[model samples]
Target: YGGIFTPTEAAGVGVMAMLAIAITQGALNWTQLKDSLLQTADTSAMIFAIILGSEVFDAFLARSQLPMKAAEWVSATGLPPFGVMALLMLFYILLGAVMDELAMILLTLPVFFPIVAALDFGLPPEETAIWFGILVLIVVGIGLTCPPIGLNVFVVSAIARDVPITAIYRGVLPFVAADIMRLALVTAFPVIALLLVRLLD
Candidate 1:
């Protein structure tokens, strides 16, 4: 509830609140809380390790100079910066069929992030970065509801296997399209993401 705290501190408070609730409800006793803390520590360590590993990998890639070279190649194509971003998103959507979202993020962030960051979208660099991250998250959520590797589809499949997979995919297509439309707005207009802040301020 503190307005001045950074997001990292906010998240820490949120987790503490959840831990407090679990203890109150007896869902997390002393022994269970200890286990949860251990698990959280393990996961957090692995996440940072991945971040550091990815950083080193990004450095290696930069040293090779291929992405910059590729960006130069792309810049020569005369496409708008956001146009290039749209094309990149389509590629991510297609890739979602083959790879899970987190895998795609982990593997490609090192490569694509630098490329996107280098482009000018009239916004500051950090705003562009946040916009692109939201775009990737939206695309991944779409992928989860889609076919070939749809996590939601699989979850629903067992509940309604008699309902043909094709039929389910057909049914969900409109919802997915709606999601795409929403994300398209977010991609094209950054204000939607910041609307709450604008209103509050």
Candidate 2:
């Protein structure tokens, strides 16, 4: 909250804090610690594999210039800014369904950011960027709860072994709907996204 730590540093601090609390609570036995370390290693390996795969996929897309061509086509259509934005949002949702959220952002931004920056969204350049980011984040979150490839659902399933995968997916449907509504609200009224940023400013 103080903004004194980078994300990686913050994660380290959080782990250390939790470790201290667990020790104080008499919950830091050697067996439990070994199990926790093993679990962490396993989880990290899975995440690393996913990230590596996404990186390879992103590289393939970049080499193919598919995103750039899509952007060029959209630009050629001369659609209204809102129409273009709608299409971009739809594309993001679809892409996010199969792609890692981080990779999705990095792969599309180079093409999409320039397209967005060129359009007049009735907001300052910085504000437009922020609003767009929030929207993408919401969409990515939706994708994360979507079925067949919802990474978050799978991750949760790993932790909650007794819960059926189908049940987990079912549980996330409401969240997906809510996120869609949020995306719509933010898209229709960009100021909703910008309000807090303005307050902070």
Best candidate according to TM-score = 2
How does model 1 fare in lDDT?
0.72
Tens digit of per-residue lDDT, candidate 2, span 1-201: 689998999999999999989989998987998999998888777767766776787788779987788888888988899989888887777777677788778878888988898999899999999998888888888877777667777778766778998899889888888888888888989999999999999
RMSD of 1: 8.0
The weakest ten consecutive residues by lDDT in model 2 span 46-55
Which residue pairs clash within candidate 1?
A: none
How high is the lDDT of residue 86 in model 1?
80
Q: Which candidate wins on lDDT?
A: 2
Task: Name the TM-score of candidate 1.
Answer: 0.59
lDDT of 1 by residue, 1-201 (tens): 668679989998889999889889888888877887886776566546544554565456457764456546655677888888887777667655545566657766777888789888887776777778888898878876766656566546545658987888898899889988998898889878766645775
C-alpha displacement of 30 in model 1, angstroms? 28
How high a TM-score does candidate 2 get? 0.84
lDDT value for model 2: 0.84
